[model samples]
Target: MIEEIRIQNLGVIGRAHVQLGPGLTVLTGETGAGKTMVLTALSLLLGGKADPATVRTQAQAAAVEGRVVLPADAPALVRAEEAGAELDDDGSLLLVRTVGAGGDGGSGRSRAFVGGRSVPQAVLGELAQALVTVHGQADQARLRSPAHQREALDAFVGPQHRETLGRYRTAWAERARVDTELTELVERAQDRSREAELLRLGLGEVERVDPQPGEDVALAEEAERLAHAEDLRAAASGAHAALTGDEDGGTDAVSAAAVVEHARRLLDQAGTHDPTLAALATRVAEAGYLLADASTELGAYLEDLQADPRRLEVVHQRRAELGTLTRSYGADVAQVLEWAAASGLRLLELEGGDQRIEELRATRDGLDASIAELARTLTLGRAEAAQRLADVVSQELTGLAMAGAQLQVVVEPADAPGPHGADRVEMLLVPHAGAPARPLGKGASGGELSRVMLALEVALATAPHDDEARPGTFVFDEVDAGVGGRAAIEIGRRLAELARGSQVLVVTHLAQVAAFGDRHLVVTKSTSDGVDVVTESDVRPVEGEDRVRELARMLSGQDDSQAARTHAAELLELSSVGR
Candidate 1:
């Protein structure tokens, strides 16, 4: 149910808020009083096309917002969640729309949000259909949409065929998945073969290099040592000679030994008197021994060192190969291996596609047979449901003053099978005897079409809907058009009957229809402040003097007349008892 509609700065009406109640609510006003603006605001809430002209003059923007109460299990909640929104615990959906940017002067935009989460305008539009249906001169033409046809039929069938349709849809979804896989496999089969060969060749090329993980550091150090081998040997030999004071023939061994003995004798003489001097003499002896050992090791190292060009060439070749793989994959051999593994799986799948195709063909054939059977069963179910729907619709038409107008549900073969079935069904009508029946799109007039649409809606009122979780609120802009007197009275009564389980709002000029409303709102125009529109609602239960005055004004444009008041009073009394 719609809780309230609040609009601001949108065309002629600066600001207006309407609090709606559950029953037949009527809106009556003089021409051009902006009564239609209310419908336009509702259209924006339903994701209708936006026009910059809707913005009030000198205003930067226009806005429309509405609050709706839904059932706990409403399908609208599921759609909201899919769009990354949540609903209130009380199942209220808040919708908002804004138009006209600062000063760009372009077509304004609109958006919807649920529980403070933004959603696509299309998603909100789909949900809005379940919350409200608008009937008017041009807007009522939407009743011809194929989607509406399917939905109407679904409603007519109720839950009797739900499980079967559910199964059909599930199988169709799986079939689509397989078809997509098959198409991709066929497109890439040759490419995968070529790619697999390239991977194998690349892997083999890198393997031949046999690159070690840390070998680059080790090889660089070895190359540096070999590059300066001769220089290093010369430096080491000079150091050895300096430390030993000429290793070959610079000093005699006996002289060196004598020096050492003299130093020790001097230390011994002072040792008993000075321990500090003895410690210095011991350190000099140890240093002389260390220098002698270093000279020996350096001589051996210099002889062993050599430069090898062949070894350098081998190291450079391995490094170059490793570099290629590193650039192609990553800076590591492990990463290259991982890439190869993933590519191999994809390659295998592609290579074996022909075989997979054969297997899928067999499965597809079996599914085709199953779907065919289900389609036939669905057609049978629709045929049965169609008959019952036609009967109910005929009954509603009679009450809506469409007497002798035959309503027919025509089910025919589709050019191709759909998820629902292989048949297309639509409502057709023959307005009178001897008149050939024609499809709704081709037959009904503006007012007749509106009434037909209403009949279908009333006939399809089953267990409400998952998206609504309750009966939808119906809004009729001019449902009573081309109707008057007894016919208008009957139409009003039928609307009131529909309101027993759902809320109904009608825009009409007919006093008979207006009298049936449980709540009445009148829209008036004033030029005192540059042509503003205002709507006033009488919240109290209208009866006796007040009801007669309001209906009298609607009837003859003069509520003060005694005769008009008397007639209006009689009309209300008759409607109350008839209802």
Candidate 2:
């Protein structure tokens, strides 16, 4: 419920503060006295589009703020909290919206705030759903739309029907997904088959070679050695002869081992005289042992080294084969092995494309069956709900002075199931008995359309549903337009009745409608001239004779006229009795 609204520099309203409460509150004034500004302020608070043209002349910006009280578990409260907003100690959430005048002929910029925290304008729109419902001439225009008609009927069906509708929507989405996948699989069959054939050929080549990890590196080393076998043997033989005595050569040259052994013996004899010579003798002996070990290993290497052309040929052939595999698949055997492993998995998948297509076909068929069943449930549920809604709204129409009029909610089957359902819901009207039903847009006048919208809103509000599904406040901006006399009075009475369960605010010109308000506010316009001249408006509550004078002005052109005052008093009395 909106507790109070403060508007500044918007339209003709320079500044206005209006207090609201939990009942029907009406705003009335002369045609140019800025009564519409009140509803404009409310619209801004509700996240309506802002225009720089609506700002007062010479004002920098326009701002609107509202204080709304929400229950602890209200959806709006939960959303606001999630946005890092805090509530007042009294559990009231403050909403603020501002439209800044764009300088240099640019478009205006709008901002929104909830509970004193800045938020996106769209967040304000989301909160508006559970916070308030606004109806005006535009809403009556929307009532003529078939989609809006379906929405109204669905809202009136309560929770169970809503659950059914939700299930149908979910199933429809799943069916669409499965259908898309199945279509792709069927369309790309030839492409997948060709891909599978290529994978099989590649796998066959890799399996034939059967390369192992590090085989390429090992083969390269072995090939190098085999290619230079004779040179390696000559080098090893020369080193072996140098390290030991060349007995087969019959040379008198001393070998490295023999020289080091003689040097160690000479140092050992001199070590009897000096300790430093003893350390030198031990070092020479260690060197002689190392030379002997190297000579033995070199001799073994020369013995093992043999020039075999057949083995060399085999190594060369193996290397050429590896090079062929590398050129086609990878830079080396390791990379080729990696490619083979991944391609093997992919080949299996491509080979199973036909089986996968069959599986997807089965899944799509299952989804189709489920979707069809849910669509039927929705159609049946909506048909039942349409009848109940039509009956209830028809009863409301009777009270709104359309006694002979009847509302017919027609649900006809569409060619195919849509996102909503398989039915096209429309509202038709029979103005009186013995008349054929016609669509609302073609049958009802502007006044009748307004009443129908009002009737539908009242019915939905009074329907059995969870509190979360119902808005806490309802605002009507001249919903009583094109209506007068008893019909106007009935509209007021029904508004008062609707207010019994929720907060209602109305901007009206009719004294009959204004009389039913628990609180009546009057907007008065005045022009001031000083250093800067400007026109401003003020909104204040009226009661006793003040309210009567305002209502008198509404009824006639003269508020001082005793006859209009008397008429206004009578209307108030009649409204009280009706209430």
Candidate 3:
């Protein structure tokens, strides 16, 4: 519930703070006392659009802020925490919005901060939806909407029905998904045939290539060796000739073994004094042995150094095939192998048979049956709830000076299955006996609309669908606009009754209604520092003479009238006993 509302430089209000109470708080004043500014402030606090024009003439910005205290179990608190907004230990939350001067005829930029953290307007608006229900002239008319009627009916049916509805909706959604899949299967049956052929062809091509992991690297090395075979053989022959003398064709005719032996003898004579020469002699002997072996191997390789054209062609063809598959499907040989396996599996699924279709049909049937049964159960629950709701609202209407009105909830079959189930509900009203029953919007007067809204709210509050929140606060903007006398008193009584369960705020001109508030506020116009401003004063628990005078002023616009004062006293006295 809203604890307090503070407004500054907004419209006719300049630096005013109105403290609200826990129950019904009524605001009343003369025609231009700026009672509407309070509503405007509430609107801004609830994330309504702001305008620079709402700012006072000399002010640079307009600001509206509210403090709301939530019940321990309220969902708004959960949402607040989710939005990273701070909350007091006692579940109190604060909402603040500021509007500044516009740059290009646009409404000044507005922002909302929950606790002290900046929040989007949408987050604030969602919180407001659960915290406050505002019924203005337009909102009263909206009660007749079919969607609202459904929501009200659902709310009236209680949580058990809601749980059932949720289950039904879930089942229906599942069925829809399966139905879509089935439809696609049937529609693409021919297309899948062509795709299956393509997938088979691709699989066969990849399989025939038989591309092995690491095979590409090995083949690349082997191909490099084969391409340089001529250069390799020439280099090998020259090296062998340098290391070992050609048969009867080279000088230094002693075998490499004989030269190494001579060097070894010279080194032994020098002893360890020439360590470098001795090491060189040992290395030369090892080199001589290595050269002798290379020469023997070279003689065998020269006879077998010729390239095979067929083998080269085969390697190139194999490489091209692997490259084609790599470019088309895989990054490399390994990836191509994995792709082939997965495509084979997908191809098997696409090639559906009678058995597969039957299986899908059976699943779809079970889902459909569950949803349909749940829908019927939901519809029956709605009918029962609607009957009870109509009775309660009708009773409330009589108290609102609509004695002959008949209120009923009409449920019709849905055009198609929907998430809400298979029923469409609407609120119908017959203003008087023998009058044709029309929809709430068609025949209800503005005052009647207000009363109907109030009655519905009262009903919904008493029987909330969710345990997380009951109705928090109800706000009526001039709902009693065209009412007076007993009707006004009736409105006040209903509001007070509503307040017994949830907080309520009503704006009214009727003194009868205003006098019955648990707390009363008078919005008055005054000149502050040569500027017209609107302010509020709490008139609850008003005393003898002052109470009489205030009521008199509200009644006849004349505070000094004796007759009006007497009437005011009598009205308050009567209201005290009635309440």
> How do all models score by TM-score?
0.78, 0.82, 0.82
Where in model 1 is the C-alpha error above 4 Å? 46-50, 65-130, 160-167, 207-228, 232-304, 309-346, 352-370, 462-471, 535-567, 577-579
CA shift of 113, model 1, Å: 5.2
Worst 10 residues of 3 by lDDT: 535-544
Reference-based lDDT, residue 280, model 3: 76
Q: State the lDDT of candidate 2 residue by residue for 157-206, as single tens digits.
A: 88887888888788788878878887888898899888888888887988
- CA deviation > 4 Å runs, candidate 3: 30-34, 47-62, 89-91, 98-101, 104-110, 214-217, 239-306, 323-335, 338-342, 352-360, 464-466, 526-550, 559-561, 577-579
lDDT minimum window of 10 residues, candidate 2: 528-537
- The residue-by-residue lDDT of candidate 1 on 1-579, one tens digit each, is 788888787777777777778888887767777778888888888888777788877777888888888766667656666777666666687888777734466456665665577777787687776677676766456666655676677667756576678888877777777777777767877786787788767657556655565665676677778677778877876665665556543453333434565676788678778889878778767755675677678778767766677777776776677678778866666666666667667657666778898887777777788888888888888888888888888888888787788788888999999877888888788887788898778888766776777777677654334434334788888777776778788778877877877888888888898888888776665553655644233122355676678788878889898888888887787777223
- Stretches off by above 4 angstroms in model 2 are 12-15, 32-41, 50-62, 103-110, 116-118, 214-328, 331-334, 524-537, 577-579
What does the lDDT read for residue 308 in candidate 3? 66
Inter-residue clash pairs, candidate 2: none
Clashes of 1: 2
Of the candidates shown, which would achieve the greatest lDDT relative to the real structure?
A: 2
